[model samples]
Target: GGDNLKAAIFSAGFKEGCILLPLLGARAEVAFGPAGLGDLYVTSTSPFGRNRTMGEKLGTGKNLEE
Candidate 1:
């Protein structure tokens, strides 16, 4: 999903850049809500991002609270 979106952004002439997830999350929270922009962050970093990985692990039955 991010790949496709990245390709679109690239084709549209936006240079690729990496903004740390927490910072992005913070800005999004300010704009969106206290719950944070979880979907936007996850989808933006999907497939290999730490947040995405954590979400995947949790989704697959791994427990973070041990």
Candidate 2:
């Protein structure tokens, strides 16, 4: 050890993995609920993703509906 030094960190910017145990349980409950109705909060990280739709609409100066 150099000068008795210790360095460790866990952060989003550092790309550390987080175990979302609470969120996992909540998501299961939401999926089981009838009102949830398969609305699993989807987003597009691909060309087909609704993200692209939003971006296109934004470029066209049109408001995305839902």
Candidate 3:
């Protein structure tokens, strides 16, 4: 049960990150240029679930503690 819980948490986090990262990158590209996409492809492949979540929240104008 503990392992399942951990897996579920990881899954949810990754899903949210994967969803937000691209959308935000698209917005950046629109506002700036192709470089706005930045290292999206590279970052998305890394095991940075928590980092991605943080980025998503910041990108959406939400507080990190939120």
Candidate 4:
């Protein structure tokens, strides 16, 4: 993915700087997007994040779509 981004930049001759940040305190789908750069990350806000207040939901067998 990093390589892909670099390629997109190099191939396009992009020289300007841009900022990219995961929207904080927002749903991941909304935070990222149709152009989302990275694979799903486990952040503090994610339901499965480390220190998950309710524990990693996946380990508990919760459906991902729920």
Candidate 5:
């Protein structure tokens, strides 16, 4: 899935450097579970959004009580 996304980005003419952070962010989610998702939220282009906030809280051991 990530590989396909990467290929698409490259096909779109984006250089490796431009997409490295995003790929790494995606890898975090695939490799680290919720904690990785949190990291992805912070590291990806979109930061401090609702999903990111939730991921961060969950990564910090917060339960989804609500």
Candidate 6:
């Protein structure tokens, strides 16, 4: 679907951006943080982010690590 494709593009953009934005924040934090992202949190760039949708999957018994 066109809409799904567009949504995936946006999602990837956000996750990729998260990979960048926090790295440029500082040196030490970047070295020690998750994916070198530090404690800086990247919120969903859209309401349709997978993390947001995970709530439903969790309701179905999916673990956070899944």
* Residue-level lDDT tens digits of model 3 in 1-66: 487876676566555555675677644233233332223333444556556667878899999679
Q: Scored by CA lDDT, what does every candidate get?
A: 0.52, 0.39, 0.55, 0.41, 0.53, 0.55
Question: Candidate 2: global Cα-lDDT?
Answer: 0.39
Choose the strongest candidate by TM-score.
Answer: 3
Candidate 3 vs candidate 5: which has greater lDDT? Answer: 3
Task: Write the number of the candidate with greater lDDT, choosing between 1 and 3.
Answer: 3
Comparison by lDDT, 5 against 6, better one: 6
Give a tens-digit lDDT track for model 1, residues 1-66. Answer: 478877675444322122343455544334334233444455454687666778778999999972
* Candidates sorted by TM-score, best first: 3, 6, 1, 5, 2, 4
Q: Could you report the Cα RMSD, in angstroms, for every candidate shown?
A: 9.7, 12.1, 9.4, 11.5, 11.6, 9.3
CA deviation > 4 Å runs, candidate 2 = 1-45
Greater-lDDT candidate between 4 and 5: 5
- The worst-scoring run of ten residues by lDDT in candidate 5 lies at 28-37
Off by over 4 Å in 5: 1-43
On the 0 to 100 scale, the lDDT of residue 14 in model 3 is: 53
User: Which residue runs does candidate 4 get wrong by more than 4 Å?
Assistant: 14-66
lDDT of 4 by residue, 40-61 (tens): 2333225654445335676688
What would the TM-score be for candidate 3 when compared with the true structure? 0.38
User: What is the model-wide C-alpha lDDT for candidate 3?
Assistant: 0.55
